[model samples]
Target: MTSLSPTTRTTLGRKRNRAASDRETLYAVLDEALICHLGVVHDGTPLVLPTGYGRDGDTLYLHGSTGAASLRTAAGELDVCVTVTLVDGIVYCRSLNNHSMNYRSAVIFGRARALTGRDEKMHGLRVLTDHLAPGSWEHSRGVNAKEFAAVSVLALDLSEASVKLRAEGPDDEPEDVAADAAWAGVLPIRTVFGEPEPSADLPSTWSVPEHVRTRVSEAAAQ
Candidate 1:
């Protein structure tokens, strides 16, 4: 468990300015995001692939087919960078170049190791499933030994990470603001959950789980 280091660079760019140094902020953003872009060096070339992930405490778990090439390479001793971004809105400004997005993102850099133990694998799978559908883990079928063995899990420590965020309207210079008359403001964006639709094959006796119901309610309230 390594602690997050301070980011030295600072710029007006949202990628550099909206950064959150606190560990809690980074973890929260990571937890909320459904997908993460994993960046690793393969054969001396950089590779960035988006994949699903789960977080437990200070570690991030990524899973894939056991035969995956990227997973095989990453499972070995190698440093990897994982990034997650959540776009909150579009920032329109008077100047085209000044226009940007409001977003929260987290970048984690660490060495990844394959999880092999049965207990660890189960735990990792539970975390991954729950991360996607909060309460689905308990409601859904558990993984069998064969199924678990067919899947590969990689664990990355969350230490050595950074969080960057940008919120609010565009940053236009006074001169540009006066010269341009375009609408300049933020168009708020969000990930909304639509009305729950029962699965086509779901048994008639089955009812919507509390987790699903609660999440729908929360999304509606938002």
Candidate 2:
């Protein structure tokens, strides 16, 4: 139950009861999520975009097209905010105002540095690729020089971060609980990976690989 030391900006302003100070919770939330919203201030205007990310220990990697202005600007000693959220269930309460969601979320604030060296860039790409499709990096084709040159990867250290989770049942008013008329409970939510469909151009005789098949089963079982 190691906890993260919260900074001024990382502190929650509202609903303090739901805040989670454990570092393990932050790591778990990030590892479980596929997409994260990246917020950056570009030219005095704030822009938030959903992007794929990967984590390696204390470093977070973000990749995108080299021509993307938002990412390009963010790489230049600019501060950014990255967030990942997972909804575990929907909470229904006796009153509409009390209705809420059971969720796990993490927010990270840091200045990102762009990777320029070939080795560093390749390693970053490997981390990102492996996170998205575990064994695909080793099984699939390698990145060519031209393709690698067209991509940009940014690395941010996870020093200032926070995790907040809400996993309790509905909290109804005392009077509502006495009445016991309204239905209240939690509806669980989950994301399951479906069977892999081969590309149309591929030969019909070709079968799915072991890694792909295993991932689908593992996701469903969870």
User: What lDDT would each prediction earn against the true structure?
Assistant: 0.78, 0.85
Cα deviation of 222, candidate 1, in Å: 1.6
Cα lDDT of model 2 by residue, 16-83, tens digit: 78888988889899888998888887678888888888999888998754222344553365578888
lDDT of 2 at 152: 79
On a 0 to 100 scale, what is the lDDT of residue 196 in model 2? 97
Q: What is the lDDT of candidate 1?
A: 0.78
Off by over 4 Å in 2: 66-75
Q: List the residue pairs that clash in candidate 1.
A: 18-165, 19-164
TM agreement with the true structure for every prediction: 0.86, 0.94
